[model samples]
Each structure stands twice: as structure tokens, then as C-alpha cells.
Target: MIFLMVELMLGVLISVAFISLLERKILSLGQSRKGPNKALFNGIGQPFSDILKLFSKEYFKFSVVSMKFYYFPPLFMIILSFLSCLIFPVVGGFLNMLDELIIYYLCLISVSSYIVIYMGWLSFSKYSLLGSYRGASMIISYEVFLFLLILLMLIYLLSKGQLFNFLTFQSVSGLVLLIYFFYLMFMGVMGLVSELNRSPIDLLEGESELVSGFNTEYLGFMFSLIFMSEYLMVIMGVLFLSGVLVWFSLLGYFVCSLIIVMVVFFRAVYPRIRYDMLMVIFWEIILPFALMFFF
Candidate 1:
């Protein structure tokens, strides 16, 4: 049983990794280029190739970039993501200690923004430095909404029935569940989009302005880890957001996964938003709804 739990985690991790590759393939198709056909199933093996490259990468010490703490961002990000995953209640069984799990999830997901900021500031480039400020500001802006959204879902959950583990929320009253579902779904999508750092809200790292943004100084593996974590966080949001037994709740993930992939593919198809426009949308649109939904 313990082994099965480990296996389950590994399986989902593998699925998340594949999802990243598929996003790349779809993006390639969007850009009028054939994506990785060298690997099985048009680059199914690319993830492994990426892993190999990541291991082979040599860390460079730039005069401007801080080598001392360069390891903390990705390291903490990885630890946090995995730590959050462990508390997600696999197999829906009796729990030994669920309290720590909740705290772990919050701490892990909450500090993720710091990882982005750290990467940006540590780069020591003008672009990276500025990008760090923007990224942190954007994260701070959305975090209030994110917390309010979660609180709203909890309120609806309480109305429906007992507040147990994540999966238990699936057993709520039909009407309440539907309401909770919609609220959670939107918040999850919002979280995913924020992590992606792209337009409609790409102010964090507007590459045209920041010259590759936070990742300007990172090359090879460092760059890959930062990028990988972004996608991973999004996928994690999708998976965790679906942590329930309801068929439609799980179904929402399929829809979200499809939309996220398609959106990523057509990413360049849309024009970037102005930085200030991002602020307006977040403040006027998302925050108001978030505030009202919670209250």
C-alpha cells in the first residue's frame, strides 16, 4: 500500500511531465514548425532528453549574478511543490496526520512567488532586476484575490456539508457543489495563468521590454528549471483543483487541461497586453469578484 502511494505520485508526476511536452508540441504547431518528431510519439522522449541536459548543465558564475544563493530558488520550489503534493490525500483513505498537510500546502504554494522574484533579482541584469520587481508586484496583487477565492470556496463548502479533506468536498449538496465548483475552477485557472506569466497578464516579464525577463541570465539547466517549475505549478493547480470524487469536478480538469494546452499553443497568436492594463484587469475585474465572492 505504501508502495502504491509512491507509485501513484510517480504516475501523476510522469503525466504532468508529458503534459509539458504536449504543450510544446502544440506550440510548435502554432508557430508553423514541426515539433519533436525524433522521439517516440513526436518527442515523447524529449522529457528524458531534457532531464539529461539538465543534469549535464554546468552552473556558471557571473560577476553580477549571485552564485551563493542561486541554488535556493529552484531547490525550494521543487521541495515546496512535492511537499504540497504529499498532503493531497491519495486514494481517499483514513489519514494519519492531515493537519500538517494543510499547512504544507499553503506554505509551499505561497512562497512560490518568492522563487520567481529570487531568480529575477539574482540574475543581476537590468532586465532581470526590473522583472523581479514587476513579478513580485504582480504576485502580491493577485495573492489577495487568490486567498479570497479560496475562502469563498470554503464558505460554499461549509454550506453544503462537512469540511473534511479535499476529496470530501465532492460529497456536498448538488447546488452548493456546483457553486463551489465554478468558483474553484475559475480561481484555479487564474492561478495557472498567473504562474505562466503570459498575457493577458504578462506584465511580470514582458520580454519585448525586459529582454527575456527574469530568465535573461539563466542558461541551460537554470533556465529549464525555472520554466519547468512554471508549467509544473500550473499543472499542479489543475490536478489539485480536481481533488474530489464528483465526475464533473474531474471533468473540469479535462476541460482546463485542453484549454491550457490550446491557449499555450496559440499564445503568440494573441497580442501582448500593456503592463498597466494588467493592473486594471486584476484590480477592477478579478479583485472585485473575488472580494464579493468571499463576502
Candidate 2:
């Protein structure tokens, strides 16, 4: 078990590194520019080089009140993101008890949400505070839709007396349910992206207004940890939707790859939206639609 866990963690780290490179390459192509081809193997080693750059820098203390304030949040963010990934069964080699989906998701959301609040509160800047507030609220708002979608899936799974089983579509109703499930899953993915503070909804990091938002005071290795945490969250999101899309075969792989591509496409194509507009989309639009689906 320990070996499997270690292997999974290593795999996640390597995948995340490559994913970072892929995102840069995709975005660069979209903007008609070359990206990160200077490193080893035509920039295949870019993530490692970037990590080395961050680690070589001196970790400086800002106007933080205590050592705890300076260190705890980023460490917790990294740890929580790690934990979220560890709990999910990403690789086929390891076996996890399939019944803990609810518990796992609840913990993932709670810890992820707290990390944002922790960063904002610890930073001791009004901008961080405000960004944290917005981030927390936005996350909580979208969380309702996410939870509803998950609950609907759980209900279906429970009725079938199976957990995380997506291949048993043996009827017309089942087919319809599968379609609806993916529809809700897409919405869930959007909510997850919002929680991760990706582009198009990155109001928390509104540089024009918040000056990098909740992470304004973070620098060097500290900032790298935060950045890695964000990447891990993105991985978690892919693992999640892919897990749901798993049906009979290795479709999860295709689903997972598609999601990463879609996220990069979104970043490349979309502009950051207003925070209020985001809130409206979540609360006034998504919530009601999700509730209708739930019923």
C-alpha cells in the first residue's frame, strides 16, 4: 500500500510537471509565439528547471506577524492538494475502497477552501483578505452545484448497488442518465475550475485590482508551493471528471486527456470575467439549473 501510494505521488508529480509545460506550449501556440523550447529535450525539462530556479532563490520573510503566518498556509495548501489526489484512485494498479466518494470529496472541498482563506488571512493585506473573501465565497457558491451533481450520481450508484461503477448502462433510461450525468459533470468541472482560480474566472487574482489577490505576499519557494498546489488541484479536477466518465474500458484516459486540453483551450481563448458576473452565473444560473436536475 505504501509503495503504491509513493508510486502514485511520483506519477502525479511528473504528470503535473509535463502538464505545466503542455499548458504553456498550447497557450503560446494560440498566441502565435514559441514557448519554453530552450530547456533540455526541447523544453521537456522546463518544469524541473523552473523548480530549480524557484528553489535557488532566497526565501524572504515579508511583514508577517509570526512564523506560523509565513509558513503554515502554503504548507497546508500543498499537503491538502496532495491528500486530495492521494485519496482518489487515479492509477489502475492500486485499489481503494470504492465507498468513500462522498467522504473524500467533502474533505477535498473543505481543505481546498480553507487553504484560500488561510492564505488570505495570513497575508495581512487588505487585497489578500478581499481576494480570499471573494475566492472563498465563489468556491462555496459553486460547491452547491458540484455537490448536487455528485449527489445525483451517488443516488444512481446506490440504486445500482455499486460505487464508482460507470459501465452498467443496460437500458434506455440508463443511457439518458449517462448523458445527464456528463452534462452535470461538465458543470461540476466548471465549478472545480472556478475553485482552482483558473483564467476566465480568476477574479481573486485580478492584477488590475487586487495585485495578485490572496497570494500577493508570497514569493520564491513559497509561491512555487502555491503554484504547485494549483496544478495539483487541476489534476484532481481531471481525475474527478475522468473517474465519472469511466465506463467499461479505458475511456477515463481519453476523458482525462480531453479535460486538460479543454482547460488549456479555455485559458488561451477566454478573458477573465468580472467577479460579480461569475457570482451571478453560479448562483442565479447554475444553482437553479442544478437544483432542477437534482429533482
Candidate 3:
């Protein structure tokens, strides 16, 4: 168990590094620029170098910030992000050990939401506070749709007596079912992307307005922790969706990579949508489409 857990953590860290590199490269290509080419193997070593540089930097905290609150939120954020991976059913059947996977996941998300608000408030900065407010609103907007979709999947799995049995779920298919599955997958991916505050919907870090969002005051190791936690969540989201959409482990990996690439593509091609338009799209369009699935 210990070995598996260690392996999982290592895999997650390495994956996050490469995902960062991939995103930088793709975004650079989109802008007609070469990104991270200075590092070894055509910038393959860039992420690691960046991580090392972040850790080597001097850490600083403002005098007005409460030491406990200021320090704890980033740690909590990263820890919760790590715990979110437990439901993935990867390595040594860790997920099987948990009976209430969905409940656990939802709980983690709820707690992380509070942590985001706390991180912003602890900074005692107007920019951070505003970002937190935007982050909270964006999270709330998509979380309902995400929850409904997950609940729908859970109900289907329960009715089929195949809860957590993703392989079996993928095997039972038809044209209608395939189309429906793809639709849900699309919705799920968008929800995950929005939930993670990725590009196009990244209102939290709207540099034009929020000035680095909730982590504006964070620096050095602290900032890196928050940064890493975001990417880790990205990997977790991709893997979870892949498990639901594909059967074989190898195929699931391919699907995960494909999804990550798709996310990077969106980040490169699309400009951030306006905040009101974001809320309207979710509340009026996406939410209604998701609700129709229940009927």
C-alpha cells in the first residue's frame, strides 16, 4: 500500500511537470513562438528547472497577514488536491477501498472552495478578494451541473449494479448510447475545465482585471504549491473522465492525453470570455441541457 501510494504521487508530480511543459509549448506554437527550447531535450527539462527555481527563491509574507491562516491554505489546497486522486481506482485498487467515492469527491471540492476563499481573504488584498469572489461564483455556477452529471452516472451505475465498474460501463454501448456518452463527456470536460479555472473561463486570473487572482499575494514555494495543486487537479479530472469514457487502461491513457491536448488547444485559440457571459452560458444553456439528461 505504501509503495503504491508513493508511486502514485511520483506519477502525479511527473505528469504535472510534463503537462506544464506541454501547455507552454502548445501556447507558444499558437503564438508562432518557440517555448522552453533552452532546457535539455528541446525544453523537456524546463518544468523541473522552473520548479527548482521557485523553491530556491526567497519566501516572503506581509506583516498584516495572519501567519496561521496565510500559511495553512496553500498547504491545505495541495493536500486536498492530492487526496482527490484517491478515487481514481489507479494503483493497488485504492479507489475500491472507498465505498462512497462520489461523496468523498464532492466533499473534497466543497472544502477546496472554502480554502480558495480563505487564501484570498488571508492575503488582505483587494485584488485577491475580488478574484476569490469571481472564483467562488464561477465554481458555484459549474459545480451544480457537474454534480448533476455525476449523480446521473451514479444512478445509472447503481441500477446496473456496476458502481465503479467503468470497464463494464464502457462495454455496454449503442449508437444512441454512444452519442449520449459523448455528449456527457463533452459537458464533463467543460465543467472540469471551468472548475479548474483554465483559459477562456479563467476569470480568477484575468490579468487584465484580477492581477493574478486569489494567489496574487502568494510567492516562491507557496505559489508553486498552489500552482502544482491546480495542475494536479487537471490530471485527476482527465483521468476520472477517461475512466468513465473508455474501457482498457491503455486506451484510457490515450483518451486522457487527448483531453489534455484539447484543453491546451482551447487555451491557445480562445480568448477569455466575459464574466457575465460565462455565468449566463452556464446558468441558462449548459445547466438546462444537463437537466434534460435527467428527464
lDDT (C-alpha, whole model) for all candidates: 0.64, 0.74, 0.80
TM-score of each: 0.81, 0.88, 0.91
Once fitted onto the true fold, the runs of candidate 2 whose alpha carbons sit more than 4 angstroms away are 90-95, 161-178, 244-249
Residue pairs whose backbone atoms clash in candidate 1: none
Residue 196 in candidate 2 has what lDDT?
79
111-195: candidate 3 lDDT, tens digit per residue:
8777888888889999999988887787779999888877777667677777465433333321123355677677777888887
Which residue runs of candidate 3 sit more than 4 Å off their true CA positions? 159-179, 244-248
Where does model 1 exceed 4 Å of error?
Answer: 1-9, 64-66, 91-103, 170-184, 196-200, 246-256, 262-269
Compute the lDDT for candidate 3.
Answer: 0.80
lDDT of 1 by residue, 57-173 (tens): 887777755576776676667656655555445544534245344445556676887777887777668898888898877876677666665566566667766664555543332
* lDDT-sorted candidate list, best first: 3, 2, 1
Give the distance in Å from residue 242's predicted Cα in candidate 3 to where it truly belongs.
Answer: 1.3
Error of 2 at 224 (Å): 0.9
Residue 223's C-alpha lDDT in candidate 2? Answer: 88
Error in Å for residue 219 of model 2: 1.0
- Among all candidates shown, the one with the greatest TM-score: 3
